[model samples]
Structures are given as C-alpha cells and as structure tokens.
Target: MSPVVIPARIKKILIIKPSAFGDIIHSLPFLNAVKSTFPNARIDWVVAHGLHTFLEGHPMIDKLWVIKKDQWKKIGYLKSTLNEIFGLVKGLGKEKYDIAFDLSGILRSGLITLASKAYMKIGFEESDEGSPFFYTHKIKGGMDNHAIDRYLKLAGFIGCDTSSVNYPFAPFDNHSDICNILPPNYVVISPSAGKPANQWPAEKYGELASMLPLPSVVISSGADAAIAERVVKFSQGKALSIAGKTTLKGLMPIIKGARFFITNDTGPMHLAAALEVPVVAVFGPANPVRTGPYGSIHRVIQKKLPCSPCYAWQPCSHWRCMNELTVREVFDVVKEMTET
Candidate 1:
C-alpha cells in the first residue's frame, strides 16, 4: 500500500483517540511508533476529561486537549459545551497540524478531524458513523486483527515503523497511598465491563478469587464499585475491595503488584496486558481477537458458542455466552497461566 504523502517538513502531529480507557491504552504503541518516526515533531492528543488523568504528564505527548464528553452530551450544558468545542476547534485550527490520525472512528472524532484542518487526516476506512468521510486518507483497518495491530496498520500507513510495539505509559508511583493499603501481593480483579453483554457474572469472579492461592483485590470506577463489591462479597474474605479508591494513575501500581489479573473484558484488562501482567480475560459476546488481553502470556476464557463474537450491546435473554462460563473454567486457566 502506498504511504500517505508526507510534507517536506513534518512539524505538528495530532492524534485523536479521545476516550474509553482500553482504546487509549491500546494506542500507546501507535504513539510509540509516531514518536520514534517523528522525534522532532510536537505531538498532541485529544482525550476525554476523566480519562485524561491516565494520559496526564505523558512525556511522549506534547499536549493534551481534554474533552468534556459526558457534559457535552447533556442538554443542560449545551452552551458551554459548544463554546468549549468551538474553542478547541479554533485552537487546533491555529496549529496547522502536518498530520492528524483519528484513531477513534466515530462522528465526534470525525468532526474533530475536520475542525483541526490537518494537512492529512487519517482514519480507518471501515470507521463507523461515517467517520471515514473526514479523513484525507482512509486505510482499511481490518476488523479481525487485535486492536493494537489495527492501530499499528494506521501507523504503518503513515510511514511510522510498526516493527517494534511498545506501550509508553505515563509514570506512576508504586509507593503511593493506595499501594500502602494493598496486600503485600495479590491478584487484581476488574469485575466490570462497560457493556452488560461483556461482563462475566460478579459472583463467578468472587468464586474464582476465593479459589486462588493469593488474596484478590477487587477494583472499579466509583460508578462500578457495586460490581467490585459484589465480587468481594462472594470471595468470602479471600478478596478485598479497593474499588473507587485509586485514580487511573494510582491504579497502575496496584495492577503491577498483582501476580496476575482476572477481569471481565474491561479497560484495566488492557492495562494489565500492557503492563505484562498475566491476564485471564473472561469473554462473552465481545471478540477476544479484537479486544482481549493482547499478549501471548495471557489466557482468554470464553464459553464458545456460534453466537459468540456477536458483539452484542446488551445481554440476550438467555445470555448463555456469559452465564454458562463457570468459575472453575476460568480459575483453571488462571492456575495454568500463573502456577505453571
């Protein structure tokens, strides 16, 4: 495939992958390639407000444009939201980015691409919500590939080297306050998924945790604390709750401390994968090929059914895909991955 045309001098580069914890984590390798390829260029990123904390103080990225996405969606905040968006557009327009890659293939991201007036706006050809139309160059980011590889294809398209994939995470302190409360060594359980369809039952997680040799620390965002708490409740004192206690940055050390990670297709699962923490990723409707724990050291446990990879937004009435996936099945894999 012919590479996107390069400007004589590539100066300012923009990367648009605004939100979703896992998606942003997956983009780190792409960021690595871009920085390595254009070491001198000033690179900037557009990230969602709450999630921006994860990318905060990233040395690889020159600046962060925090988008108040949740507030933007509310009718009550329309005026402020518009003003914020307009200011963002106006500010980005002044940068005259030599190249911009919309890693996110949604209409909002597409609009950001248009607003930037990038010399070359790159996005996936199969991007949903007609996001492809805004791209000056559209690359076919194959659906079957892992999210990392799919993102790398775009890197390769823009002349960035994809041979070496590395996650450049922002620095986090292992000795922070949250870490003080954690057990000397424990397994991390991210007992929540953004979608109902992807989640393995919380009680199952507790069962798995109870059987594990190491103590388990259940974690989640403030909103998802109930799910984490449910897992802890089922662990019968074998697991403890650290949910809502740590920020995105603070959680890194906690995960790093884990001997292994057990999660139900959540963002932190990707984080653990990136951190080289052996992960037993439970899957249901979501395709592990596209978004499971990425590295080879990890194990993916799923109840194989023809309807799997359906990528359902909500669990079907029966929801056998997840319901039938027993705790023993997942625990055995975890033991195989960790004990062996």
Candidate 2:
C-alpha cells in the first residue's frame, strides 16, 4: 500500500524540544530551515522553562511555550501544573497548528504532543525507547544520521525540503561592553561539562590558558561556578571567567565574536559550531562520532583509551577516558586552530 501523503498545507507548526541546551542548539538550524521554507508559517517552540532564556528574543519563533519541570514536580503542585499544561494545549489549539514535531523524542514531549490538537504529530521510532508513544508519523533511520541532520530529515517528512541547515542568531544587546573587553583574536576556553565524567581537569584548562598568547575568556554554565573559578585562577589573571555572569541568551553575542572556542562536548560547543565559529572540542564518555560538531572548521581531541566512550552514568569512579587527555594535548589543538 502507498504511504499516506501528508498535506503540504502545514502553516502553523509546533516544534517540541523540551530539554538539554545542546540538543536545542542542535535543533536551531532545522527550525531556521523551516522558517526559510515556509516564511508564512507560524513557528512555535515548546521547550523546557530552564532553556526559555535562549529563545527569548529569537525573531523566527512566533511563540515560546515552556514546561517548567521543577514547579510541576512538587507534591502539592500537580493541579497548577496540569492547569498550565492545559493552558498550553488550548493556546496551541487556538494557533491551529497543522503539524507538531516532537524532536526531543521523550515522554514529556510525548505528553505535549498528545495534548495538542495538531493534525499531524511526528517523532522518532519506538526502538529509540524512552520515547513517548504519541506520534502519528514515526520516522526510522535516524540513529545513523548526525543529530542535526536527523532533524533536517524529520523536517523533510513535513515537506520542508531541508537541503541545508543554517543558523542565524540575533545578537544580544546587553553584551556589547563585554564584547569590547575581549581581545580581537581570542579563543573561548569552556572548561566545565554538565557531568563530571565528561570534564577534563579544570587545572589543566587553567594551565593551557596561561600558555596561549592571545587573551582568553573562560565560560561555564552558571551551575559550574567552582570549576569556572578554578580556570580563572589557573589562568593567573590572563583569563576572565564569564561563567555565572551571562544568561543563555546573553552568551551568544560573546560566543559569536570569539576567534575560536575550546570546549567539552557541551551545549556551547554545539552553539559555536552552529554559529560557524571554529571549535576545538574534547570528548569522552559520550560518543563524539555521534554528537561531535558536524561540518568542517571544527577539531576534536580525544584519547583512544580502550574503555573510552563508556557512556558511564555521571561521576563515574573509573573515568580515565577524559582524564587521560592532558592539558598540553588540548593546548596543541588550540594553537593549531588559532594559527589556521
């Protein structure tokens, strides 16, 4: 039997990606591509409340719907949370979305997809597991594709003709003074990772910061201030730690202006890669082959420990994978990236 042809009549689309900063960053190009293909379409995003800051003033997003997990998890908060969820569903229904894509492919997003009244609901196949079973159109063959490319392919199923994934970001206004302070040819050294297992030694990054000829800025999520402080201290006053100073939206302008970015395989690494900034990413625990920066102009440093890419639960005791990477090796890559 011939597959059912989804009506190309999709104008109002809801993109459901509700967690992880890096995954959302990876999805931005696909979102941008959707707008490029359907300029008239109203593109609404449903993301985690924590990441709402990143999309606050994005020109292409027609609406930003957020799900606050923390508030919803409290014992007495069920009624209010459900009401909020219902309100989101009603608001989404009023927009009359013709299509909703569950890009995050998780249970929470599955609930959101089920709640919405869009005619077409799409998500990943079941074998990916942990995925909610609410999609009307489930696309196979995503595991082999790069994460960004997978989103493009999903867009294709919706008639988006996503031939190219391009990300055009709006510069945040508040950081102009911060940008001025950075050297013209500086590299951003992002030393902290969300999980301890994925992080290289902060002392090593501080050591590397001191060796670099160009002035440097150290970045970390506000949650990792201790590590950020260590990098700043290790740089011996050569580096500025902007870890807790900038919100997600405010950091883009700083990243866009940097000459190069050195990071763990974290969200900003994906953002820098998406922005076309040169990147030197260090990888361990997670599979770099699956999630490393895609396209040219990016370099990755990884040691081939036999137990590397172990995908350990965070804060593993036996983390020689990332620990084996020395400051000197990462510095060599940073020098190469800056020179070329």
Candidate 3:
C-alpha cells in the first residue's frame, strides 16, 4: 500500500465514528490533529443517535450526520431501518467528500465509509467484520496501544502532526440550576459501567461516598436509575441521587465544578478526565492501560489478581476484581487526591 498523502487542495472530509461514548471521546484527539493540519477543511462527522449531543456544537466539526443506530437494530422496525440505511447512503453519495476516515472499524461503519463516495477512504488494517475491504488506505492500528494513541497513528499516516495530543472541545456553560441544588465542592460518583463485570458494587460505591470529605452526587442514566438508587440508599443519606435528571451537556458543568470524580470504567469516567477533573477510577475486567483514564494526574484502583483484566463477555462468578477492592482503598485515594 502506498503512503497516504493529503491532497494540497483537500477541502471536504468525513469522520465515521458512530457510537459508544468513550470511543467517541477517544477519537477527539485524532479529530484535533486533522483539523489542525487542514484548518480550512470542512470536516463532518457521522455520529450515532443519542451520542451526537457531545459533539453537537464542537468547534472543529462543520457538520454532524447522526444515524439512528438503536432504532435500526430493532427487528420489528425492518422497513424503517431499511429506509434509514438507504436514505443515509443516498444522502452521503451526494456529499462528494474528498476523504473519509472509518475510525469505528466495524461492518456498519465500513458500509458508511463506502457510501460517502469519497475519493480516499482510510481505515484500520486490523478492522474486524471485514471492514478493511472498503478502505482505499489501511493503517496498522496496534491492538495493545492506548485508544487515543492508536487513533493518532492514523493522523500520522495522513501526514498530520501527531506529536502533541490536544482535545479541542468547546467550553461548556455552567448548569447553574443543577449546581445550585448540590453542595459546594461536591464529588461526582458515576457507579455505572457498560459491563456488569466492570462495575463496583453500588453498596461499595455508597460506602466510599459516605467516607469522602465532600458531599457525593451520584449520576445515572434513566436506564441505570435502579443502580443509582441503590447507591444512594446504601450511602445512608450521605450521598444525593440525581439519577435520570441531567442531559449529556448538563452533566459536564456538574463534573467541571466537582472537586474530584469517582467512577467505574465507563463513559462518564472519560468525560470527567476530558474535563481535567481529578478522577479516581475503579477498574475490574477491562485493561486500564488501553482504556483507563489517559492523563498522569488521575488515579486508577484495580486489584492485581492474575485473572484480573479478563475482558470477559459474561460476568465472572466471583467478580473478585471489583468485589475485593475495598471501600477504604478507594476512600484513601480520594483523600490523597483532594490533598494534592
């Protein structure tokens, strides 16, 4: 394969990274590199439904094409799903993009890349579900590298300066109404994880929250309301449950003003890290090296069990990785972070 050379007259580009909030956050630095290199380019992103709000008013992106991914997955909505897919392809075909990058290396994203009708399509060489077949250019995105670094490698392949990693998010306005309800100098605790194996017990989170120097504000999506309620209940009135209340945009200011954050390995964890809030993340099944808090200031608490970081699809029978991590251990780390 010949090296990817950015055309001097490059004008339009599309980035296809559809869903999963944390992965989208990981792609920001790559977006920054491309936008920095081609300051005048009209960069568009194909984001998934519900998750597009994070990048809705981002400075670097010119357009955000949202796809209804969840809606399309419903077996009952076959007709609408087909219509959406075909309509999206037809619309993308009309855009005439100069280049398209498939950062989300999956079959669906690969199809979107092909549909864009871009002259140059770039994707990972090791992309699963035969996603590489549609790529005009394939870059070796290593498996073991941190997600942010792996994405930057693609920027380097396209001759962008990858030396410095910058997350160029627009400043979020303070949700003063939300802030007014909470105690000053509060700590945000995000106890939900995508995988059950990655989650620390809600009772454990509550215990940790109760021990913190500041008041704890527990956040949760509508789907995780039960878990959030359990955390608040277990806190014995020490923590406040604001579950199902804030939108993605609303959550930022809450995190921004937070003294520090405590979370399971999840999307909000990445959000807190992006906001430069001090974070104490608890890791279990997943490898923190690849997807943990990125910066040096944040702290990660995980057990050193040999079977830890298993990355399992099913919940572990014992779940010792998270179960064994004591509330005292997490509380101690939070205390240390506050002092610093």
Taking the tens digit of each residue's C-alpha lDDT, what string does model 3 give over 1-340?
3447677678999999997888988899999999988999999999998989888888899899998898877899899889989999998999999999999899999999999999999999999999999998898888888889888988888789988877777556777577789997788999988888888899999888777777899998989989998999888788998888988878988988888889999998988888899889999889988899889989999999999779975567888888788999988888887788
Which ranges of candidate 2 are over 4 A from the true structure? 1-8, 126-132
lDDT for residue 1 in candidate 2, whole number 0-100:
18
TM-score of each: 0.97, 0.91, 0.96
Residues 205-247 of candidate 2: C-alpha lDDT, one tens digit per residue: 8888899887788888778888989988888788888787777
For model 1, the stretches where C-alpha displacement exceeds 4 angstroms are: 5-8
On lDDT, the leading prediction is 1
Per-residue alpha-carbon lDDT of model 1 for 1-340, expressed as tens digits? 6777565378999999987999999999999998888888999999999999988889999999999998988999999999999899999999999889999999999999999999889999999999999998999888999999999998898788899879998877866787777789899999888999998889989888889999999999889899989998889899999888889988888898889998888899999999899998888999999998987899888887988889998999999998888888887788777768
Query: How far is 256's C-alpha from truth in model 1 (Å)?
Result: 0.6
Question: Alpha carbon lDDT of residue 193, candidate 2?
Answer: 75
How far in Å is the alpha carbon of 277 misplaced in model 2? 1.4
Candidate 2 lands at a TM-score of 0.91
The 10-residue segment with the lowest total lDDT in model 1: 1-10
**lDDT, candidate 1, at 258:** 89
- Using TM-score as the yardstick, the better of models 2 and 3 is 3
